[model samples]
Target: MSKIVMFDMDGTLLDLSFDDFIWNECLPERHAKIHQLPLSESKEKLYQFYQSHRHTLVWYSSTYWTKTVGVDVLKLQQEFQSKIQARSGCIELLQQLKEQGYICWLVTNADRASLRLKLDNIAIEHFFDVIISSEQVGYAKEDINFWQELQRLHPFNPDETIFIDDTATVLKTAEKFGIQHLFNISQPSSLKDIKQHQDLEFKTLDRLTELLSILNEIDRKDNDVKIA
Candidate 1:
């Protein structure tokens, strides 16, 4: 079986503080200034607008939001580049996964511009065997059709692959595509409490070593049975 491991970028590998800062703080502040409304009112209004297209591809498009919100999101992100960083222990986890012979791919809903910015900021781009953006695939990860297209372009057996993501909605879509090994990152943002989910969740990337050990043992036993 192909030991392919797919990772989500924003929350899984990178700290989500940057995104939270943009959506919850920067954009809202900009909206308040542009519309001459109170900050709180602008925040509420923009948040409602954000929710209206939460699961769609447009939600992840930096350019789309920039136009819609009448703000330069990409420029704002650059201004707050200090907030873009990898989650603690993520680099170690990626190294361990590579040493264990797993093919690691970064699969994210982030648009190309955002992806490039974050990757450059963290300098962890070389860690991934391939980085795939949902924008390139013409679908959001929340759609099963996106997974189908992903598999078509970069083939892997869903049963043999493991996918780790912070978003429950995207995980559900991956499950619908019959991905057997799934994990949820309970703590996507350090500022927030661990997000509850029905599936097994990891609080940090440090648990990755143990998780891979268990998978390796299971694979060993299965191999032994086949030999016998």
Candidate 2:
């Protein structure tokens, strides 16, 4: 039987430093400039908004943010499109998965516009068998309905699936939905400190290619069980 691997786009397959720059630095500066407020004040206000909408669909929507924050968030991201980059060993892992005949899916909470922007900059789209945005599902990945909708759209055995994401909340949702193998990224952003595995709910991978060895080990264990 073939196994399916589901990956969160940003912070999993891609270096999240670009997103960190856009949200934490660029957006606040732009917001402050537009509102003629102090940078500190703007950051505090935006941080409050972020906290309120963190795992919601609106939180991931560029249009919603553009209107609420009075800045064109999508346009801002495009301005720094050059900074968008895949994580180290990202392509190598995808290529190996494709060659090895494992089905690959990109499951991201990024709204359609943001998803398009990232795909336009990175050349990893062709590697995925299916690419889904939470916007299309009408629910954020933190919501169980997103998984239900995803399964409805493209049927796959939950027990045969592996999910990798950087967010603990998203991983917990997937776990609740019964995906068998759940993994987290230790260092999602090149700009941030590495997350300790003890802090994460699932196994944390420091390198993208480490997944290949993990998959091999899982296969080995399954074969041993079958032979026994």
Candidate 3:
């Protein structure tokens, strides 16, 4: 039997601090400079925009943001691409899963342009059997249609699949879609405080490699059940 592991790229395998810095810090400054507004005013305006588009496919599109905000959001990310980084133990976890014959998929809400930027900076692309951007699916991961479209494109047994993401809303949608095992990252951004696992809806992983032991235990139980 094959076990498929689906991972969210940002905030799960990759540290989300770069994204935080780009949106919360860098973009605000640039928006202020270009619009000749106060820094505080720029942040307030951008926050409103973010709140309105939260969890939507438009929220993830760099092209849409650039046109709406009048800033080349993708170019700003490129300028600071050096800050892009993988989360701790990310490579080790991916390597271990590969060695154990698990099928790994990189399923991300990032648009194709943003996904390309991250992949260009990080060398972990070779680890995934399939890499999908929500842009191709025509919906964000927060929508059930994304999962449905993904299944239509590349069929997988949801009951045998494990999904790990940093966002609770995305996890909820995946659960609604009938994926069996789900996980949330305890600390997605190195710059931010670690989240309390008890507060999260799904089980949390503090270290990316912690998943290896969890998978081992799950397999052991499955074998015991078969033996009995």
Give lDDT tens digits, candidate 1, residues 70-162. Answer: 888899898999888788778888887788777889999999999999988887788788799999999999999999999899888887777
Candidate 2 lDDT by residue in tens digits, 30-134: 999999999999999999999999999999999999999999999999999999999999999999999999999999999999999999989999999999999
lDDT of 1: 0.84
Best-first order by lDDT:
3, 2, 1
Candidate 3 matches the true fold with a TM-score of 0.98
RMSD of each: 2.3, 0.8, 0.7
- Model 1: worst 10 consecutive residues (lDDT sum): 199-208
Candidate order, TM-score descending: 3, 2, 1
Question: Clashes per prediction?
Answer: 0, 0, 0
At residue 106, give the lDDT of candidate 1.
Answer: 94
Model 1, C-alpha of 24: deviation from truth (Å): 0.4
In model 3, the worst 10-residue window by lDDT is 217-226
TM-score of every model versus the real structure: 0.91, 0.98, 0.98
Residue-wise lDDT of candidate 3 within 94-155, one digit each (tens)? Answer: 99999999999999999999999999999999999999999999999999999999999999
Question: Which ten-residue region of model 2 has the weakest summed lDDT?
Answer: 195-204
